[model samples]
Target: MYRIMIADDEPMIRKGLQKLIQQSGQPIASLRLAENGIDALNQIRESCPDFLFTDIRMPKMDGLELCRHTAELDPDIQIVVVSGYNDFEYAQRCLSYGVKEYLLKPISKKTVEAALEKLVYLHSKHTSPAFVSVHRLEEWVGEAEAAIWSLNHETLVKVVQQARVEISSHRLRLHQLIDLLDEFTVLLFKRLHSRDIFLFTERAPLHAADDEDSAWSQFQARLVLFFDELRMKRRGKLKDPVEEAKLYIEAHLAEEVSLEDVAERIGLNASYFSQLFKQSTRETFVQYRTRRRMEKAKKLLAQPHYRITDISGEVGYADHPHFTKTFKKYAGCLPSEYRNKLGIDR
Candidate 1:
């Protein structure tokens, strides 16, 4: 029978992990919950658990301090650090305190199961020598970090897949894979931090996997989904504002349409929207509106029923000579000349 403790500020996370450990069918002798690192430390002193799952950021003594204290109190207890974001520097600090496994936020059944399995393995090997030395662990972690920093998603996925396969093949322990993945995630996020991408910010809870292969497969699927959804979201962001601005300009061709008015309609700052509009459409607002009005005047001129003055008014111009000069500049011909080219005369 193994005693386990979950330390987190979130009631839901603590209760949820407790339920998952009980349902995993692991020989869990007892389960305990703590709202923060201080409470967790008190609980440990009162009754030292064989294993602990803790969140890095917590009130009244963060997970890092708790890990350090736990190490001094009970060096034999295995700990898995739980967190949401990937802070590589912070992870290195935690690793110094003997934390080998990391569980990402919104943890699911599969992750919980894997974590517990790793804890069980640690429990079994507590009195025995470690198969992989500390030096080897650092080497693998370095390799994982390099793959993530290279920014080649395919190569990174392949590297992670290879590691996953080793775990599935039983050549590597589950805890070791979790450590690599945790490092990879931290490096990946640090690389992508300045890109304004929100892939890791919010995530739904993933379901538990029954085995290593299933866990790895789920990880791959989530990556693909992240790229697909991120692409679609960014495309929409670039396309939507310009398209809406164009529609508004087209609808009010005879009225004043300033950048501020169009930006207001789109719920964006005028200067920012102006930049985005030009970036997306490759034309300044003045140039685009002038071209649109000239095009409309040309079409109306083709009808032969509308006079030059009416056509000018239709295209938002009240002065005939000014409109004529503008038409000649845009269309390379006077309005009458354009009508003649179209074989029409009033």
Candidate 2:
């Protein structure tokens, strides 16, 4: 079974091709349609299709550019250009972009079936028994590891799904599929360990299944759940350090605070902590501290009994004039001006 996408500007063409493909009795697992090249590319990025049937000219991005990007994204994808142009230059360019077939407009059932037959043959040839070696398991594991590190759940799930499909299509024995999944899990464990991820504790072993489909389903579920746990653990782990630093900063808002001081208090390297803080809060440590101090100064300025000079000292500013300048920059007015605008007499 193949997942297919059709891209064309004409609604009638898109619907016609979809109908013909459905009626062609091809083993299609799913079908998608796109009104333009850009929409097709976006759909491809979310979930890659086994085959792409696209028109040459569309709004936003053209077919040539879509073909180029699709080739870059997944060279293994079989592309069929369903354009009305019938231009030699377009065919030549598509060939260069690795398009498997080009069908001219006014497509008939015979031509569509022929293209599908050729594409199916090519697909089967590519996924032959010779291609399903033990090395393929390693490739999947490598791809899964990269996805896990990047925290891309969609890509990770897609990798596992592809593995299942390939194993099922190749008719690997139940035992062979289990062995492949076991090896994949072991490899992921070692790779994640090397990166200090350490997700092995309290993990359950793979479940046994009598059928290959059941085995694949169990493996997929276990792997995805494992990744979900890893994501949550890492997320919480990352937040702990940043949260500790934030608490320490809040506690010392009225005192001199430096990035190094907070990093040391949180037991993280200064440079790493700086990067992590910015990534988490979208603010540098200095910027966060300054903003907090200004917020405190604003509250103090609003109190009629608090002198501006005393307010500056209370917010970790030893120099009154400097605090007044910073307050002007931050709030668009000096401390006295701000209080006066608030209708408070000092």
Candidate 3:
């Protein structure tokens, strides 16, 4: 059983959250509600609750200030920021203060339940010493972080799986195992952020399972999926901006194209785009466009139906002599001579 507190200026929000938590089936020994941060802080001083739920904006001692105070008073208390504001800065600030969860407004019952499950697991981990020690867990997390940074999928998965085996050998309850896994995830997130990866903003919610084996399997699958995403991002394979730019260039090859135009279209600065384009394609944007234009002109020249001047206009060159000069440089022969070698004449 655990004690919980909810602090918000809105009566409806406070009551609604209280009802949701009660129905969540968590082991709540007592639940307290406060209309403002000041009241919540006062209640916390009287008796610090196991968990604190608060809104960012409130009369007298806003939630941010309250979080600071609560962290100073009791670092053990798990704080969840239930704010209507979806600003990233607020969420980042709350995380800095060791807030466990940050839920946006219009909260859903499922989301609340998921958060409670993880927070309760955290509380149990804190109160019990039978589980792994802080130092050992830190060592495991450090190993996992190194593996993740190096994109060593095998070693990373092995590290987590080995930890799970040790935890299971202790014969902990199903929820405790699940909670410990969630705690490991939170720690992993913090570690990766310190390395500048920043893949996850919060601990991912676990899937509901009735048994330990199923729960463990689900967790393993989630870990594998996360690793795949990390690998792709590290390799620059996921949503490649250069690939997008290349597709745009291919489609508009016949139109007047500039590096600046392509960069702005793809939402990147012109200079950065130039560098990325060269790195990905091994050619400058102008070189690529020119090569593509010459390729198209050669294909059209083989037909003998289109005039060289018309081919020039088709490839975005209104100046016939300029097109001929570029084609000669690209193909090692004048356009007319190349056509003659193909056994076509106009």
Candidate 4:
């Protein structure tokens, strides 16, 4: 859906265009009106309109001035000049701004239709190509590690491919950018398997577009906005009911922290909490707790401070036999083999 803005000092022209645009039933999903260039500038700043229709002349600020402002604001905004004159000089000047189509006023629905058709087509080609988005996603992730902390060749290649395939079903939009920040926070502190790919993809889109300094400001804003959105969502504090349940599981990994006890503490039905936890994290509560244990188990194995039996107990396996099977499931190696590899720091 394209959002369109019409800027004209004349009330009749603005209203008439708005009505004509709506009546035409064109592809434009939303239409906004600004009485003059000043009002139009505010609208441009607030919401980046997909298209702008402006008269060539106005009193305090002319259309040329508006075009210049809009260019500084967002170069991607498509402008279609509405003029009552046929002066080629003005046309030549507009070419510098890359105006889409200069329409002579006393305009009809047909002229507006043609302008929208061209604008929409151009936007798609520039912004939404399938392979281009995927390629950009990959390149963005691959570059991020170099810009911050380098990844090994194996990890770099693996991460970019994982990011491309696992960006979630979520689509990017101006508003959803807020929620993404919250998601980022969750990913940062949450337990991650070696395969978790989000921190790579999370920054990929921004890296694809801006430098570190500029992107950092925007990234922080997204997080702030997300907290605001969370307040809205919970109607109070960002009520994450599953948090306590996760905490309890972590505290009692060896004791068989069943879904029943964890869910009961959160005051939610056990089955329902189980589903929501899985839905949000892509891992069931049991699986996540076990994975966390295994990760701890690996870290302990790497350290020479603890013996193998002690490490198994540390990761919540009372029986070394049980720890061995679980380690094999995740590591494809017995606990002793993994421990031996760590002796030389492989």
- lDDT of each candidate versus the true structure: 0.72, 0.81, 0.81, 0.67
Q: Across residues 86-109, which tens digit of lDDT does each residue of candidate 3 receive?
A: 899999999999999999889989
Give all TM-scores, in the order shown. 0.37, 0.44, 0.38, 0.44
Stretch of 10 with least lDDT, candidate 4:
199-208
Candidate 2 lDDT, 88-174, residue by residue in tens: 999999999999999988999999999999989997786566246767878898899898778898998899878777777765534
**Where is model 1 poorest over a 10-residue stretch in terms of lDDT?**
198-207
List the pairs of residues colliding in candidate 3: none
User: lDDT for model 3, on a 0 to 1 scale?
Assistant: 0.81
lDDT at residue 287 of model 1 (Cα atoms): 89
Model 1 lDDT vs. the true structure? Answer: 0.72
lDDT of 1 by residue, 104-207 (tens): 88888998889888878877776343244556445544554455444456765776666555444444333333434445444444444445544332222233
Q: What lDDT does candidate 3 reach at residue 243?
A: 77
Comparing 1 and 2 by TM-score, which wins? 2
Tell me the spans in candidate 1 whose CA falls farther than 4 Å from its real position.
128-346
Candidate 2 lDDT at 258 equals: 87
